[model samples]
Target: MKAIRIDEFVRDLATLSPKDVPSPKPKGPRDIGVQITHAALTHVDMLYAQGLHQNNGRHVKPPFILGNEFAGIVTSAPPSSSLRPGTRVFGATLGSFAEHIYADENGLREVPKQWTNAEACAVGASGAISWGSLVSVANLKRGETALILGASGGLGVMAVQIAKALGAKVIAVVGDEEKARMIKSTGADGVVDYHEKDWENKVKAMTEDGQGVHVVYDAIGAVESGLRCLRYRGRLVIVGFAAREGKMENIQANRILLKSAMVHGYRFGEDGRQDPTRTEEVWNGFMDLVVKESIKPIIYKKNYVGLESVSQALIDLGKHTVWGRAIVRINEEAERELKARL
Candidate 1:
């Protein structure tokens, strides 16, 4: 089978390339073999490729495959598992950017009949993260206000739709006028251009009585600035550090205390690993929304086809040049299946 692996930590994207590797077989009673169809490009893949997340304890230094979420058909499954051979599924797995990979039955879910593998792959992890953060972590309620930073990124776009689905009025913060327009298309109540000096003020003004938002979805790592847009007792859910890396420093305790607000950090995969059942609930919930037409993932216009294109996809991800999600078509059959559905 073919896979993209990071043999060593190199600064350049050119360090990544396609290589032939032995296809993995199910090694556990709960494991199933997946003939992967589509893999989504993620910032985590970029960080891991450059060896930036080594000390995080969740991942080790590489010579490892490069994808986290994928949609595929089942080639092999344990007799005891509910999933059978030929089941169409989407889920998270290490080394997902390959022709074949093994994932536990617990992580895989049957994809809906109406969805293409590319659509499923695009929404898989990002939907889980958004649903987990909004519905699980923040407990966002109808009629509440949410200010979503980085509202045009892969996860951000999902966050916007999820927030709106939950009946929260959204104030989307994007990098420029173009992204603002893109986010506005999702029915956000207001859009703030972060490039503007008074963007925070703009967010505050958009909220009820200028009281600020009821929740802050801080993917941008602008926690301090995000705090400025919080309502009393508001929850700040930290899902990523797309804007900057490293721990937030010198934050005054009074900033949190004065607002009587709660600041929480969430890592979707880590949370899912610790509580598999809840993760399944989130995945199913998001899929239900998809089937019901309450929400939809915004896939980027560009297609990163095949394993060989993954390196450039990762580079574009790191540069923040691409919006929504990057879909990588891995198998010819999967591509044909998706097209046939359309």
Candidate 2:
């Protein structure tokens, strides 16, 4: 099996490359072996590759495989597991940028029959974050208004659709007119370009009576501004720090207090690890939306084929050049098989 292994942290993403590595095996009864067909590229992968993410030298170390979200066919499974060999699935696990990976049964789910592996792979991380933040943490309700930051990026796009699917009016905040236009079709009731002066005020003005939104989903570290766009007693969920260049933000307590707002620092993966039951609930809810075709992965138009393309994909994500989710085709054979069935 060929895998993208980060032997050491490097400043340049271009220095990363794939190498032939031993295939993963099921080490526990709960482990399921998968032949990875496609994987989604994210800013987390870029930060991890450059040793900038907090997980670097902490939760994970060097000489480890890269990637987390992937879709593939089950090559092996426990006899008691519902996912049998030859079943198509999509899920999250470490070292997804490889030909093979093994994950706990709780980490995998059957891919919806209507979607290809490429599309299914793109949704795992993004969908989880959106569902967990809006539905679980924020408790977004129907007929309310939700404002989403970084609305054109991977997680942002999914967040917009999920919020809309939940019957909330969505206001998307993007960096520029191009991004604003791109996210408009994702069912955002209104689009605000953050590059515009007084954009936060603009977002507030779009809500009913200029009161502000009921919830703010901030994936870009726009804490101060996100607070300004919230209604009284509103909820704000912090999912990422993309705008801060992957660094933490200094959120002022006064602003939060002024709005009588509730702040939640949400980390989907960590949250799942702490409560596996909640993980199952979130995935189940997200899959219900998928089955109804209420939300889908917004894949980037550019195609990234093969493990060798992982470095450039990460670089593009770090540069904010890739718009929706960027997917890499890991196994050509598996991709062909998936397309044939589709």
Q: Could you say which candidate leads in TM-score? A: 2
lDDT leader: 2
User: Can you write out model 2's per-residue Cα lDDT over 1-342, one digit (the tens) per residue?
Assistant: 799998988788888888999888887889999999999987778777778888886887898899989999989988899999888999888899999999999888888888888888878768877998999999999999999998899899999999999999999988767677779878888998777898889998899889999999999888889998998999999999886765777778999888999999998888787988997888888888988999877888888999999988888887777777889997858757756785
TM-score of 1: 0.93
Whole-structure CA lDDT of model 2: 0.87
lDDT of 1 by residue, 50-80 (tens): 7776433556566788888899988888889
RMSD of each: 2.2, 1.5
User: Which segments of candidate 2 are over 4 A away from where they belong?
Assistant: 338-342
